[model samples]
Target: MPSMTVRNVPDEVHRAIRVRAAQHGRSVEAEMRHILESAVRPEGRIKLGSLLAEIGRKIRLTDEEIAIFKSVRDTTPARAACFE
Candidate 1:
């Protein structure tokens, strides 16, 4: 696992994190990790596949219509890239 060092946190902010950590029964480091995770990967985030499916539903695409793409799609193997 990777580690991080957060520098120059304000005294009040550090104190607040300590208090919050204690309240949540977690170490200050764990609390910081939780905070960072929540800030970045939020609960209500919309994924690409889900968004595309929602659009298809809104547009009322039938199963047979979607299946037509599979029938027409190329099944060729992709060529690998050469660095040389």
Candidate 2:
């Protein structure tokens, strides 16, 4: 495989990438590879909105019910804790 070097990265962006790599228990190179994979890969994964829409479709919820479900999802404990 061919390799390429990315030059002239801003200091803050490099620092942020390093911090994220540490948080994910990955080497900086591995973390950058993961980021690139997510950006370039074509595999389908369940995103939150699409997952919720699928659930709504299965349940055949009314518009109001879907709105309420979205509200509850938005205010979920995990989401709230992430903000704090």
Candidate 3:
């Protein structure tokens, strides 16, 4: 395990983080840990699955409708590329 010591943090910024940590029921150190984790882990940071699930919920697709849609996919030939 590694430890970091931040020095001379601006008073305003320090106060803000302390206040934010309190708002989220966290200690200042714990809040900073979470912030660092989110900064470093790009895949962990984003919630694409949750967004996709929300989109899916709005779509209201039934199994039969999905089968129908799948059956019709790629039926048309691709348009010939235009090169001028």
Alpha-carbon TM-score of each model against the true structure = 0.53, 0.50, 0.50
lDDT of 3 by residue, 18-45 (tens): 9999999999999999989878886745
lDDT: worst 10-residue window of model 3: 44-53
Write one digit per residue (lDDT tens) for candidate 2, span 1-84. 767799999999999999999999999999999999899887776689789789879989998986786687655456345654
Segments of candidate 3 deviating more than 4 angstroms: 44-84
Superposition error at 5 for model 1 (Å)? 0.4
- Where does model 2 exceed 4 Å of error? 43-84
Backbone clashes under 3 angstroms, per model: 0, 0, 0
Candidate 1 backbone clash number = 0
Report every candidate's CA lDDT.
0.94, 0.87, 0.88
Q: Give the TM-score of candidate 2.
A: 0.50
- Could you give the candidate ranking by lDDT, starting with the highest? 1, 3, 2
